[model samples]
Target: MRMMVAGLAMMPADAQDIEPDGPDIVVTAGKPLRVDAKLLRAAQRRFAEDRPAHAPRATLRFELWRGYSRISATDVGLALTDGAGGQLPVTIDGDGRVVFATLPAGRWFLTAPAQSQGMHLRPIVLSSGTSVEDRRLGDLRAQCRVMVAMAKADASLLAMPLIGMFDAIGGCASKRFGFYHPVEHPLASATATGAGVMRTLRLSVTSTSYEAPLSDRNLPNDARVRLAYR
Candidate 1:
């Protein structure tokens, strides 16, 4: 089967890449502050022979939302790695989607977190003779859950809209689409004490795209994006 390989986004143009509107923050007094580092990407695999049976491939498409309308991202790219440390270079388009080629069939971990955010993993299983059509909403759902799990695992920072976009694409909107909508509440609040230094970072995630207090509908409003920095 014929598959199209796309590009990925590496960096944001300016500080605007970091959006401040997300889950509520709770800066505690005594919690350990851990620092994170950017992912070190390796070179893409170079194969001498490309056989049809062993040639693996896949495509990733993201419907980026800047409020009600859908938009695309720039310079979005990803690095694929097996558990063994082998890496493959993949590119994404303005829409935050990518079609990759020359992959060997096996279990591989696909991570394409925004440059503004840390690297996130999306495990993909590529079998021989598979094409984009084989990709389904189920695949997107699984990847979304993994992203949320990653954010929860990382106590340093949280990812926004990814969980929500996961909601819309994962078919949380309609059961007629054969997608199961899990019930979860998202809230952002802070607990305070007499000392007033902040204590726990309790943030509930949601799938909402636009900013709250939705007045003055801005055209180029803050789009839903992730952050990866120390």
Candidate 2:
């Protein structure tokens, strides 16, 4: 999509200059219809526009935790939005994770209202008609890995107090990694430091993936999201 906002100037350059060299091969007869560059560009533009039939169906999963424990049946609400904020249908289990199976193909926005203390979101893409049990189990497993990693980080901080503090506060302020302080105010510096470390660990554990949904929604074939706390 065109990346423009107030006061942002588009860079002027020759198309050829911006293009990169890639492998070239000649097309022969007896092959699938070859798409021209212009046609491809048009298709891309259509997808970006969030046109109907370009929306992909997806299943999302949510995993909640309190110190490495999975909490089930927490309230979850999810909706997909196009890049421009158009809503798409989305489904989630009581735990709040969306199944990849149910969504149509297209760009989607998945959101979960903050539930309980320390709830994390893990959004996944599934092809349409994916078996319910398979995706459910898969979501659980993915969340478990994240929980294990968070637990590991928590363990590391217990041994070195000063280093942990520096790692939490100093490291976050510098923006060295995706780490950040969690709470707006820390009752004590140590508490804040620990919270920051926890945030870093959470960010590190979650990731997003794009795959064809089982049912054809006629939307974009892929989706993207990161594990989000907000």
Model 1 regions lying over 4 Å from their true place: 1-60, 63-77, 101-103, 112-230
Clash count (model 1, backbone only): 21
Per-candidate count of clashing residue pairs (backbone under 3 Å): 21, 35
Tens-digit lDDT track of model 2 for 8-75? 11111212122111111112333321212222222233233432332334332333333233345334
Once superposed on the true structure, which residue ranges of model 2 sit more than 4 Å away at CA? Answer: 1-62, 71-74, 94-97, 102-104, 114-118, 122-230
The Cα local distance difference test for each model comes to 0.27, 0.28
Q: What TM-score does structure 1 among the candidates reach?
A: 0.25
- Evaluated at residue 149, the lDDT of candidate 1 is 36
Q: Identify the candidate with maximal lDDT.
A: 2
Residue 148 displacement (Å), model 2: 15
Return the lDDT, model 1, position 78.
49
The estimated TM-scores of all candidates read 0.25, 0.24
